[model samples]
Target: MKTLRHITLVVRDYDEALAFYVGKLGFDLVEDSAQPEQDKRWVTIRPPGAGPQATTILLARAATPEQSARVGDQTGGRVAFFLSTDDFDRDHAHFTAAGVTWVRPPVDQPYGRVAVFADLYGNLWDLIGPVPGGACVG
Candidate 1:
């Protein structure tokens, strides 16, 4: 079986990224190890409750101008991430309370409820929840 395991995000600072993702977004820190061979750290995070069966966010700290330029425009200023939650209202409230910056208000679509928000580094993301009686939809 094949699986897509990780999605990489170019970050400016490791600690800041960790605080945003783990502290604010509530992701779980799965790994944090030193890679002395490359002067880098191996860090990975996943959504809460995902455990070992979810795709991870691999935080790659930019080390060059080219990578730094892509930090917040990974998808050319379009939405670069999608964060789906089981409980729309709860997560929405939590995110709002945490001061997450929303670009659009929540709306109910045929597939689900969605809202656009910008992450700490200004990368756009869709915060989504499943339809009331429907399956998960992106």
Candidate 2:
């Protein structure tokens, strides 16, 4: 069976994307400046206390028009990074205070309370907190 390694997101600017992911969202800078010849910086980020082996989201640089267009179009859709949180309300408040643009306020779903927000590169993210009495089965 094929195993999932990472999810790559093509962004127009690296600095802007890095700022949003690292500065605002609190994702640590795992790998930066891996390949200089390819102009590729393999950045991997995850939530705090998340294990090292946790799946990583890569903020990739858009080198072609087609790539840029694809990422841009995906921004407004359902594609999002699902984040885990213990307190949805606190996370929502933090995002609001950080001046992050929220697509929707926090709402309780069957599985969890989720709040959708946009990154600096317009990528959508679903910040989720599991609901009480809602069992999560791996």
Candidate 3:
């Protein structure tokens, strides 16, 4: 079966995105390899404590104006990313202390407890934790 390895996210600076993901969000930096020939680096991160093969996000630095424009809102002003956690309250408290901008308070959905928050560049994301005996999307 085919499996996803990484999803590329356009970022203004690789290091800034790294700090946000690895510092505030507590994701693990999986790969940081220099591509000297191409003048770029391959920077990838995974969810904290998630072993290899979990969905990894590649923080791709924007090399062009068009790419830079997509840095925050990559899905045309919609929340295109969903980050699921096993322990919602712990992460929610952590993110609150970290000063993450939220779109709304957490609410109980049929599938999970979820809240919307913005990335540093205003990209929306859903931080979700699945409810026991419930299903989830993405």
Candidate 4:
């Protein structure tokens, strides 16, 4: 069976994307490489303490005009990314103060307290905290 690995989001500008992911959202930068010879630049970020096996997301933009149009539309369209957090309230407050827009405030659900927010590029994200009896151990 094939397993899912990394996911990359094409952005219009790398620096802006980096600022949103790192400066605002607090994801740690794992790699940043620009290979002109290869006509490609690579960059990735993840939450702190995420191990090597943790999925890494790449911040990239389309290279060609056709690709740019597609990515631009994708950015404005609805897309969701879920992230787990121990302190949902604190993080939600922090992000709110940082000018991040939230579609909904943190709400208590059966699974957890979930709060949704939009990234700089308009991508949606669900910041979740697990409820007490929500553990699954088989």
Number of the top TM-score candidate: 1
lDDT of 4 at 104: 74
RMSD values, in order shown: 1.2, 2.3, 1.6, 3.0
Instruction: Give me the runs in candidate 1 sitting further than 4 Å from their true place.
Output: 133-135
Off by over 4 Å in 3: 132-138
Angstrom error of the Cα, residue 40, model 1: value is 0.9
lDDT of each: 0.90, 0.75, 0.88, 0.78
lDDT of 1 at 45: 96
The clash numbers for all candidates, in the given order, read 0, 0, 0, 0
Q: lDDT of candidate 2 vs native?
A: 0.75
Which candidate number maximizes lDDT? 1
**Number of backbone clashes in candidate 3:** 0
* Candidate 3 vs. true structure, TM-score: 0.93
TM-score of each: 0.95, 0.85, 0.93, 0.83
Tell me the tens digit of each residue's lDDT in model 4 across 1-138: 575568988788888888888998888999999979977779888886777778898877778887677653464555467888877767888888888889777777877878788788677888887655563111
